[model samples]
Target: MYFVDTLETEGLGNRSYLAGGPGGAVAVDPPRDIDRVIAAAARRGVPIAYVAETHVHNDYVTGGLELARLTGAHYLVPADAAVSYRRVLVHDGDEFDVDPVNGLGLHAVATPGHTPHHTSYVLTERGRPLAAFTGGSLLIGTVGRPDLVEPRLTEELARAQHRSARRLVEQLPDETAVLPTHGFGSFCSVGRVGTDATTTIGAERHRNDALVKDVDRFVADLLAALSDIPAYYAHMGPVNSAGPRPLDLTPPEPADAEELARRLAAGEWVVDLRARTAFAAGHLAGSFNFEGKGRLATYLAWLIPWGKPVTLLAASPEQVAAAQRELARVGIDRPAAAATGRPEDWLRPGDHLRAFPRATFADLAAVWRTGARPVVLDVRRSAERAAGRIEGSLHVPVHQLHGRTAELPEGSEVWVHCATGMRAAIAASLLDAAGHRVVAVDDDFAVAAAAGLPVDTSDEAG
Candidate 1:
């Protein structure tokens, strides 16, 4: 029997797959951390015979090269992708045997929309199609975003995406399973996505925009809904093209209270990876809170200056280690230094912990009733702000808030909020470190209207 195992990187919202029958298996779009893939293949009682890439990924570094090297498996990459290293150049209609005993193999299908050289692989058994590994081409509900490449190619790529999705549906059987690498929560997805864990070609044909709408309508709507790509994405393509070095997961040098203090004084980044509530309760002054429990990689990589030395302070060594793995996927390879303990342990002599208040929308309303007017800062993205926003609030996306702090009123206490509390805490820390008194609204945005706050829904609110 054929088995397809999914490996999910929840922090980045992407999935990789290992599929085959009894003879051996093939790895698809593996992450930078190749050990996990190695362990998974071991658990399945099969050697990995091949490692394949659907395209030169624009979101995270791929583990294909390293995984193939270690396992002695053939590495398959799109023929047209310009890469420095040697690989098995996969072309359309090419086939490779994954498990000769069970007649399991892979068939390459060119699906150029997510990237110019993007290709989808079909897992076949005995010359019959069983599964389609549609990486960044056809997703569960919506297709992958086409704007990650050059701006001039975006519209052209969108049209290509429509054709690619239609091609999969036309060529595959209704029962053929559709497995995609992007769109769980990754920024690579476009349009409204589904929450379903599994889908098939037949189901997608009825609901996917590319299959339902004409190519012109599908391309138009997709181009309009595209949001800001993460700042770290600009480096991903180049790193993957030239070839990413082997991952270095070894912990960095340890930092004591003195070193932490000196780094903070020297204007280096000392990130605190604790629960947001624990961070808000107390942390070393000037340290930024990224919340190890939240989207640590996405936000940390997005805001920190590229190539800056970062020092990590966490409650335990385990948290620091976990954050290190997440950061490495986005190309923040290693922490300059790390400390494990409480704020008291990280603080220098004569240094005290700093704190800020965390309030809900109800608390915000109570403050307004007392006739105290503080600067309400909405730090959600532009797309979210367009849906609804609190009246009379200044807007700044959290990613851009570091450079735009001067735009806020001087000497005024700022009230910060996002759709949820995680981003609010991040923004609160940024403002706090910048010497501004801040309050983080730890509540859902939906509660704003119910809390009697004036929410503007007009187009101009964004």
Candidate 2:
């Protein structure tokens, strides 16, 4: 059997596959780039027979139905799936043979837990199962979290998942390769911080933490670390359910202040993707300051409504193009114009907002000595925070800060930091825009901790 997996790094690290044999080729966990999978099959001289999705994904759009339409292949989904789509509902014990050119067979195994309709495929070269394509149900080091769908259904989902994993262990040979749809960097993966895309069934059985014999302990531990879904997840389900939408490549030309004003008057968003200092010095008076410094694509899609025309204020022509591409990756491609003016030109004296003085790490340290201790706000995720965070910091994942503004200190000096300088800048600027004195901290967490700051973690923080 010939197998190929395409890796998409945009939102989550989603893996798509193409498997071929004498029966024909089949695609599994299809990505938005349906053409790539189709072209690969054509090169292998095989007609595609199936386009399959292991489960309904919540992190990014799935491209199974699109591939089916393009290749005239059967679109396959688990028999229990709830989402609306034209698909062949395959049940447990279902099997299919693939003859891309000559000899191969693939068997589908029902693996529910990640979602009610999740399934894994067993690839056979001759008569033996050589590999298993576990969708979100299993990863190299982690098992899929069962809480993404509904909190109330977690127990049922976990029970189902435990059974599914055990079935794979009992039915498939120890040598069978375990090829999962997600790996390191995918939120759907079990502790995917640093792991591989594929692992052997025997290896997973021995090494995967979730595969421990104690089913109750494994399920409880998995449920304990669940995270809130990204804000754009809800929109993606409807859009992807219909079909993959093509992204826009042509961005409108540069706009002057007058043109931008007229566009905004018509209810378009003039997004400023500049440094906090630069934007504070002189941005167009009413532009929404996103700064493109945090989870740019994630927050932009969540906070700004799609299909709303946007004018971008980028640092350079290259940045404008890059920003447009990133926005399109998440389906926010309807940009009307991009600004070409220097950062300061947008302000021109009276148009400028009062630039609040911000303290640097040095300034913050100096203030600590004088009793003016600022509230350190660490705007990073739970995983990043685990590595090391400033000692006296309030955790607020940047994506949720806009809605949870009340939790932050009012009228107090706020210092924000992330794993690096970028997200901190975005958070600091947002705080300033929301009428608070703010500063962007450097990457050294120990520096603040050593200086005797307060730090506490909150479950409310995303």
Candidate 3:
């Protein structure tokens, strides 16, 4: 029987797929690492016949070229992609037979909005629609933001995005699965869409806010809701356009304590990927903690200077491997060195291990009631803060905190927080490193609001 299996790239918050027929399969929107796709096809006892890319992705590097070369499959990309490679450049409405004996086929439908050349694929068996690989368009509850292309074309593409989303629902069967390549916590989505894993054309029509009949409002809200694009995104286009080399996943050389200290002294980034609370408890001085389980790639890529060599620091070899894989997704291949162990063990004379305090929302509320003055630094994004924030809390989105540190009152006591404690830990580290008395509010946002803390929405959250 033919079936479609999802391959999740969690750090990037996107998904790739392998659709297998009788003896062959097709991979769609694959990541730079092709091992999982290869393994899935091998388990299905099928050869990969084709690799399809929905667009020239700006989110992450594609493994299409490498996967095709490794598996001897045809690489399919949009005809208008201007890619510097040789393969099947498909146009709208083109169809390919994956394995005719099993009645499996792939059809390309031009759905430009996420980019000028975006395409969505509909999976068919015996000419009946089974699912649509709606890459960066017609997502589970939202469509891809249309501002990825040229600034001038943003509005034009937004209108097209609305039309394309409607076309998917109008043309496909109501029961056809809507497997989107984006929208699963990816920055590609215009706003926060529900993470419900199941999706269908009928469900989207009934529930997806972006799919409302009013195209004008959809366009307006989508364009307006586009927050800051990640700093690393600008480079993804050029790399994917020109083409990228096959992934090299070999472990980088391990750095000993002295070596790490030397690298740190030389100003190389050594990002610690332990949990936030663990990181705050005790960490190597000059290292940044971005919690490996969290959005390591997104935040690290955003903060790291472009083209800088990074040294990953983690607790276990397994964690270093995981952090390495996540880094490669954003094309941060080949760390200068990766070290795994306690920061205290890496200490030397004048090389310090630092720790910070963590507080609960209730503790903060008690201090506030006593009129104890600590700048409640709300480090969430502006959009999140605009929803609601602690009254009188200073706002500096975590991503902008590094550069905007000077804006924060010099040496002021700071209690930093985000929706959850992950970002709060990051903000706390930044504050502590800047010589401020820092405490992380290590609890949920709801806990803070319910603790009888003042909350407001009209405070010009900047």
TM-score of each model, in listed order: 0.99, 0.81, 0.97
Candidates 2 and 3 compared: the better one by lDDT is 3
Candidate 2 structure, TM-score to reference: 0.81
Among these predicted structures, which one has the highest TM-score? 1
Off by over 4 Å in 2: 21-24, 35-47, 190-194, 242-254, 262-269, 272-295, 303-310, 315-333, 339-363, 381-395, 404-412, 444-462
Task: Give all candidates' CA lDDT scores.
Answer: 0.94, 0.70, 0.87
Q: List clash counts for every candidate, in order.
A: 0, 15, 0
lDDT of 3 at 289: 85
Candidate 1's residue-wise lDDT over 1-462, tens digit each?
A: 799999999888999999998899999999999999999999999999999999999999988999999999999999999999999999999999999999999999999999999999999999899999999999998899999999999999999999999999999999999999998999999998888999999999999889999999999999999998899999999999999999999998999999988998899999999998999999999999999889898899899988989999998999999999999999999899999988899877888899999999999988887888779999999999999999889999999998898899989989999999999999999999999999999999999989988899999887
Q: What shift in Å separates residue 360 of candidate 2 from its native position after superposition?
A: 6.9
Candidate ordering by TM-score (highest first): 1, 3, 2
Model 2, 252: alpha-carbon shift in Å? 5.0
By the TM-score metric, which is better: model 1 or model 3?
1
lDDT of 1: 0.94
**Per-residue lDDT over 1-462 for candidate 2, one digit per residue giving the tens place of the 0 to 100 score:** 466555454445567788866458778887654566777787777788887778777766666776788678888887777756668888887877666345577788988888877899887776688778898876777777776777799889987877888889889888988878866456566543235545888887887766664788877777766765666767775666566665446666878766876886787777788766676565564566665644567667766655778888877877787677667656665578887657554444455444544345556667777886578887877876865655566888887776676788778878777765666766666676566777777455555555554433454323
Which clashing pairs does model 1 show? Answer: none
